[model samples]
Target: MTESKKARSPRKILIFVVAMLLLSGSLRLGSVGIAIASSPEDTEPSTEDGATLECVTDAETQELMALLRERSDRVAEVEATQAQRQKDLVQAEAELLENLNKLEDAETRLAATIQRVDGASSDDVSRLTSVYESMKPKDAALLFEQMNPEFAAGFLAEMSPSAAAGILSGLTAEKAYAISVVLAGRNANAPKI
Candidate 1:
């Protein structure tokens, strides 16, 4: 029994040593495989046998770069055009404002002239009558025809009745009819004032 136990103990030690050596070898081989697989040198271009590898950009990448450049240029052009248009719009607004100011000034001057004429005519009934008498009948009639009926009526009343009648008689038939209608309307709607 002692002899048999000694023999089995030696066999077991030998098997354990062999298993340890196999495990160590397997770990070393696995580490080597990992190192080789992850090495940058393995993926680098090799210089051998007079063969050279050139890396070139793909067509799609080049086309994408060209399109980006074109888009940038178009954006720049649009910005420039918009800036120019804004400048033109500002200039046009300034010109329009200037024209409007000129128009306002002109209107003011015209109103002042009209007021002066009205003042001169209203302040002097004698002068108004003399001017009316001096003018040709036809011219006076035409001028009176264009005046407001109320104003014409007032001016006619201020004139001598004979002079007023003469002018009325000299007026065209249409002018006479319009004046008669205005006069009749005024009489019909006479106020207490």
Candidate 2:
């Protein structure tokens, strides 16, 4: 019984030592795996010669970079186009303002010319009226007889009441009636207020 116990102790001792060696070896392997996973150098793939090679960018990364560059280019293009449009708008506005100023100057000149013409025409009408007034009523009536009733009425309106009466007296009844009608109706459309 003593010999059997001694033999069993030696076997158990050997098995324990083997089990402890296996556990320690497995623990060392696990710690080495963790160290390799944490290190940046060990994360990269090595060539057949054991030399770590530089990683080429993946297709997705390259595509993303290209997209970003394209977007940047588009943004720059849009900004440039907007700037050109703004500049064109400013130029157009300036041209319109200049044209407006020129138009205003032309209008001023036209108004002055119109005023001069109107003054000259008014003076001519007054001179003609004076000339007719100085002539014999019979001669003036002859001239008025050939004139349109409305035109004669216009001249009569500019004359003194006595001068108009003298011209009307010299005119034929029908002609005088037509002239009188024109003169009377001229103010018909005027506001009474």
Top-lDDT structure, candidate number: 2
- State how far residue 91 of model 1 sits from its true place (Å): 0.4
Pick by TM-score: which candidate is best? Answer: 2
lDDT of 1: 0.82
Cα deviation at 107, candidate 1, in Å, is: 0.9
**How many pairs of residues collide in model 2?**
0
Across residues 1-193, which tens digit of lDDT does each residue of candidate 2 receive?
7999999999999999999999999999999999887878646677999998776679878998999999999999999999999999999999999999999999999999999999999999888988888888889999999999999998899988889889899999999999999999999999999
Worst 10 residues of 1 by lDDT: 42-51
CA-lDDT, candidates in order: 0.82, 0.93
Report backbone clashes per prediction.
0, 0
